[model samples]
Target: MAKQFPHITDTHRDFIARQYVFFTASAAEGARVNLSPKPTNAFRVIGDNAVAYLDRTGSSNETAAHLLADGRLTIMFCAFEGAPLILRLYGQGRVLHRDTGEYKALLTDAFGEEPLGARQIVLLDVDLVQTSCGFGVPLFDYHGERHNLDRWAEAKGEEGLAAYRLEKNARSMDGLPTGLFSEEPAEADPA
Candidate 1:
């Protein structure tokens, strides 16, 4: 059976904090839905009705594009090592780029500092909270987070990352504009 709540209670927040991973789901009206597994450290519960996460650079910017087209977003956290439970936050999400002052302030307040490799901040204004018995969810032992992403970002440096984003992240697989880069397209690189 599933349970619903109007806001994220203290207990719910505590459960989210204990988890090591979560998943984000989003979609546009006529586009393919995206469900992405996210590390727990990247997420934060901002308030009873709000949450935010640091979105690092990835192969695609589907979430950003979908959010731009349709603000619908759902964040799910499951208990893989504890009691059998799954929590979902259904909300509207906005993608905040690092260039914005709000993004800078929020990043600092949430993480003590701006994390390297952070491409955008996904802020959610949660309206509905749901929990279900995740009896079928298998338990897995916790190991540790991979350092490969950080290492790759460090090697890319700032200028390299900017160019890469402009090239690869400006559009989604569905041809929806992600607005990740500038409105004007950059010059194409020679193959």
Candidate 2:
């Protein structure tokens, strides 16, 4: 059986906190649906009806682009071990670029100093919370988070990261603009 709620409850919040990974799905009108598995330990429940996650630099920026074109986003959490339950947060999402005040406040309050390679913060205004029995989800043993992303980002440094984002993340695979670089200072024209 499935149960639905208007906002996240204490039980739901607790379940979210125990999860190791979450999946996000988004799409624009004419673009292919985008689904991603995020392993970063940066998801936060800001309020009963709001949640946010730190989005790291990836090969593509589909979520931000899709959210820009179409705000609907769904985040799913399923139990890999423990009581069988699957939770889905259905909502509208917005990308808060690195320069935004809201992004800064949330980062400072919940996440402390931002991690390297973090591209933006994705905030979702959750409208519906649904939970169902996850009896089919298989159990898996836990291992520590891989530090490869951190190492790669550190090796790339700030300038390298900027160039890489400009090269790969400026647009989605569907050719929709992601606005990832919208807040960056314009380069001085080399006269």
Candidate 3:
């Protein structure tokens, strides 16, 4: 049975905070569905109905593009330890780019512009929340986090990172507009 909305309580937020990794899924109205795992502490609760995450530079930019077309975004946080729980936040998402006003407002003083490049501010307006058994998840020992991605971004710096996005993320793998690292989205001219 699906747990209905407004039934999820505050204790669920506590479960979310305890998660070290989560998965994000998104898709446009007419594009390939995107599902990826995020293993960093990139998300946080900002309100009873809203949450946000720092979108770092990555190989793909499907989430940003998908938000532009359709705001539907699903974030799943599984308790990989201690207890068994799979919490899914079903909601709409808005993408705030580095040049966008919302990005400045959401990230101001919340983080430092160091060690990595800032891509976008993804804010989710929760419409529903569900929790289920996560007994099938494999149990892995907590060792340590590898800083390779951070170090790679640091070494490349922001300028290089922008170029990387331009080269790899300007378009979706399905040849759809990604709207990332592009001077102007080619879709502007629908000719």
Candidate 4:
């Protein structure tokens, strides 16, 4: 059986806090839907109807692009090591660039520190919260968070990261604008 709530409840927050990972899904008009798994350490429940996550640099910026084109977003968390439950948050989301004061303030206030490869803050205004029996989900033992991304970011440094973002993160796989940078992406490098 499944239940739906108008907003996030205390129980929902607690369940979210216990989750190790979550997934985000989004799509622009006439574009393919995008889904990505994310670490929960960067997630924060800001209010009864709002949450935000610190987004790190990735190969593509589909979520941001999709959000810009269409605000629909869904975040999902399934119990992989506990009671059988799957929670989904349906919402409108927006991106705050790293240089924005809102992003800086939220990073300091909610996350304590900026993570390596940190690119943007995605704030979601959740409208629907739903939970379903996750009987099909298998339990798995937790190991630890990976540090490879951090290491890669450190090796790239700030300048390299900027260039990389301009090259890789400025557009989605389908070439939609991600709003990562104000300027248009330079011509694709020819190899």
Candidate 5:
């Protein structure tokens, strides 16, 4: 069975909180589509009509680049155990890097003063919530989150990380702007 809703409710929020992983999808009008699985408690529901997720330090900035090029994005979550359900959040999304003053302040509120904690936070102003059968989704056992990424970033040091981003990030494969390096003061880290 499938159900559609106008916005996220308390029930939806509860479902969101229990998930261990979520998928983000975005694309430019005529460019490549981007979808990536995210973990590490990178997401949260800010209001009945909105959800936000931290775009942690990573290799490519496809989502951000696509959002900069096109504001549309989708976030999907599935339950692999207990019950079977697939939740899709449809909305327009915006990227707020460390350079974005307001977003940075929001991060400060969520986190703390040590601003170098995570990367950018992509806020999705959701317009619709859809739920569908996820019976096809395979059941998987819960183990633990890998600490390799965080450890690697910590070991690399800020300067090394910057060099790495410049080398790996900067633009989307389709040549769209990520606005990553555009904000000069903030170290260019494309999520």
Candidate 6:
């Protein structure tokens, strides 16, 4: 059975903090839905009705594109080791680019430090919170965080990363502009 709440409770926040990974889902009206698994350490609960996560550089910027087109977003967390619960946050999300003052403030206030390969911040104004019994979710043992992304980012450097973002992360697979590289025109074929 599932239960719904208007805001995230302390218990809910605790559950979220213990999770190792979460999933984000978004979509534009005419575009394919995007679902991505993200590390838990990158997420933070700002308030009972708000949450934010550091968006790392990826092959595609589908989440940013989808949010720009439509603000709808869903974030889900499941207990993979101890409790049997699945929690979800439903809200409108917006992307805060690294160039923005708000991003800098949030980087300092919320995240404590800017992470390597951090491209943008995704902030969600949550309207609904839900929890369900995740009886079927299997428990997995925790190992360690992967350092590959950090290594890749360090190797690319700032100029290379900016160029790569312009070349690759500026558009979604469905041809929607992500606004990552605002100086460049949106490419029809983001190949």
User: Which residue segments of model 6 deviate by more than 4 Å?
Assistant: 183-191
Q: Put down candidate 4 lDDT per residue, 1-191, tens digits, no spaces.
A: 99999999999999999999999999988899999999999899999999999999888899999999999999999999979999999999999998889989989989887877899999999999999999999999999999889999999998998899999998899889999987775889998
The alpha-carbon root-mean-square deviation between model 5 and the true structure, to one decimal in Å, is 5.3
Better of 1 and 2 by lDDT: 2
Error of 1 at 189 (Å): 32
**Which of 1 and 4 is the better model by lDDT?**
4
**Per-candidate clash tally:** 0, 0, 0, 0, 0, 0
lDDT of 1 by residue, 70-150 (tens): 999999999999799999999999999989999989988896676667899999999999999999999999999989989
lDDT of 2 at 38: 92
Model 3 TM-score on a 0 to 1 scale? 0.87
**Candidate 2 lDDT tens digits, 94-163:** 9999988988998998789999999999999999999999999999977889889899999999999999
lDDT of 3 at 107: 82
lDDT of each: 0.92, 0.93, 0.79, 0.94, 0.82, 0.93
Tell me each candidate's TM-score.
0.94, 0.94, 0.87, 0.94, 0.89, 0.94
Candidate no. 2 TM-score? 0.94
Off by over 4 Å in 1: 184-191
Off by over 4 Å in 4: 184-191
What lDDT tens digits, residue by residue, belong to model 5 across residues 52-163? 8877678888998888888999999999776888999999998787777877787777645433335678899999999998999999888989888878888887887788
| CA error at residue 153 for candidate 6, angstroms | 0.5
Model 6 — TM-score against the truth? Answer: 0.94
| Candidate 1, residue 78: lDDT | 96
Taking all chains together, the TM-score of candidate 1 against the true structure is 0.94
Which 10 consecutive residues of model 6 have the lowest summed lDDT?
181-190
lDDT of 3: 0.79
Off by over 4 Å in 3: 109-115, 181-191
**Residue pairs with backbone overlap in model 1:** none
